[model samples]
Target: MSRSTLWLLFAVLAVAARPAAAAFPADANPDPRSISVSGSAEIKVPPDEVLLSVGVESRAIVLADAKRTNDADVAKALAFLRASGVADKDVQTDYVNIEPRYPYDSGAKVVARLQPEFYVVRKSIGVRLTRVGAYEEVLAGLLANGAQYVHGIEFRTSQLRKHRDAARALAIRAAQEKADALASELGVRRGPVRSVSESYSGGWWRGGSGGWGNVGGGQAMQNVIQQTGDGGNGEDGTLAVGQISVNATVSASFAIE
Candidate 1:
């Protein structure tokens, strides 16, 4: 054969001898040699903000009268919250609802329900206090100044994203350590990360139920007058500004070599 023809023949033979690439990627199959691990982290920090849910309810024979009384009480509550150093923008109405209340008597026979005797007007407001030092003061004044109900109060931090990121980092570090330990025990080396996922929780975890002091509802606020004092102190002891716990968990998988 001619020299150029021989070179062409060699190229053809080399190409034919080369291994063919697989149709599917290497990672398409389950990594039987990989190890999966989970890690979790928890951090406790003080809350910098306070959220108070306050409401006012009024009833009267006339719907207009009921609404007017409710508006007046809610207005007073708003003003009280603002005066307690809660900014105007932070104190706003959450909801307004009006319903008819019927009067019924339990009789021996036919118990005909009387027509609605009164209309009930209810309005609730939410206040976010950036200054936690005034949390108790705002809670106290809301009830003292016409606020008929205290739905609940929550302590949280406005810097939620910052704390959550910190927790995530810690969880990831823990996951890496765990994977390294497992791989070492198996006498294998860790390869590229196959998959990773994370979940986090924080803020408003400890919520009060029912109403203020976990008492039934708005009617219960009437009896809480003594408890909602400016001192933040109760018969037993002083207020406890507890810390909030933030947690993050991560699931990671790595291939073993």
Candidate 2:
């Protein structure tokens, strides 16, 4: 090869071997020093509303007979509820099911392909009571009027949004207080907030065999503070309308100075 051609090839090879430049310099923008903390708060208040799940189940050798019995019982229960001042909008049919019950063999296993012993028809209804005080009376009337199964009862607050907002505000303040306390111990001061995140949960608890239960959507988290209110009871003291808990958690990062 000629000297000029060899020089041109060398130049191409040198260019190909060179490292690429970075898009951003390493020291152009460094991450700020920050302190991360999490805080939570819980607010308890008397429930203003109650939700009840009631159902009726009937069985017979004929499907039509079982369905008829279930329908009549449900109608009676609904009529009783209406008479007790429950509004139409607050009452809804939750579900309806029809299944066959087969006879069990001597070995306790269900017999296959044999004639069904009986047909079962079940219907469930949801009732929302705006007046928390009338829970006992309404429940008794439901049972007397043919509501056979009590699936569950949930006590809740109508002002859930207001209480949740208040809880979130308290949680943020708690986070700020924690950051300040930590900074004071380290002989540093907390600066402007750099990042923030939050989560929340709400639920109810009963006094009997059943324990804590979730009423709606939300994940459980640690609570920093808890307060309990009066267990709302009726004049006869048959039912206890316990307070509901609204909880919130906040995670925040603040600059350290």
Per-candidate TM equals 0.76, 0.78
- Backbone clashes in model 2, listed as residue pairs: none
Across residues 1-257, which tens digit of lDDT does each residue of candidate 2 receive?
99999999999998878765555577876468899999999998888887877667889999999999999999999999999999999999888889998887766544363768899887777899989788878877887897766666677788888898999999999999999999999999999999999998885543221211331221121111124447555557445565778999999999999
Cα-based lDDT at residue 153, candidate 2: 68
| Alpha-carbon lDDT of model 2 | 0.78
Candidate 2 residue spans exceeding 4 A from truth: 1-28, 106-112, 203-231
- Positional deviation of residue 241's Cα in model 2 after best superposition, in angstroms: 1.3
Residue pairs clashing in model 1 are: none
lDDT of 1 by residue, 165-253 (tens): 89899999999999999999988998889999999887543344534344355433222222132322223334455567788999999
Residue-pair clashes per candidate: 0, 0
